[model samples]
Target: MLLPIIKCGYELCKSENSENLIARAYPQLGKIFQRFAILQFFNDYGEFVLHDVDPNLLTFFRSCLSR
Candidate 1:
């Protein structure tokens, strides 16, 4: 799940930039993008188990990615 998103981000960054800003920001963007992807995945597939999901975990994920 994450591998593909990271790869996509890498490819997008590589294609869009001449500088290494993408590489430098990969960690942050990767975290953000993966979080978004996972949330969407759960929204689409894990709808049945959504009630058991931890809101704090999502917040923590957001915090980690923000840094």
Candidate 2:
């Protein structure tokens, strides 16, 4: 019952740059991951890695490369 609401909150936090918001929502992922290492991967690389890259720019770059 409450899970959907928490997932929604996590999604909202993910779209923003607020680490505090993210941290608050981050614990909700524990049950899904089931492993600390896998969770750590998302914490370290999944969110932070390439976070500064513009999605549109990256898409354009990929298209340019494909051509």
Highest TM-score scorer: 1
- Give lDDT: candidate 2, residue 59: 50
List model 2 lDDT by residue over 1-67, tens digit each: 4468667876788788689988765664653344434434555676666555355345544543355
Q: State model 2's lDDT.
A: 0.57
Evaluated with lDDT, which candidate comes out highest? Answer: 1
Worst 10 contiguous positions by lDDT, candidate 2: 31-40
- Cα error, candidate 2, residue 17 (Å): 2.8
Q: What is the lDDT of residue 50 in candidate 2?
A: 57
Model 1, stretches more than 4 Å misplaced? 1-20, 60-67
In Å, residue 33's CA in model 2 sits off its true spot by: 16
Clash total of candidate 2? 0
lDDT (Cα, 0-100) at 23 in candidate 1 = 55
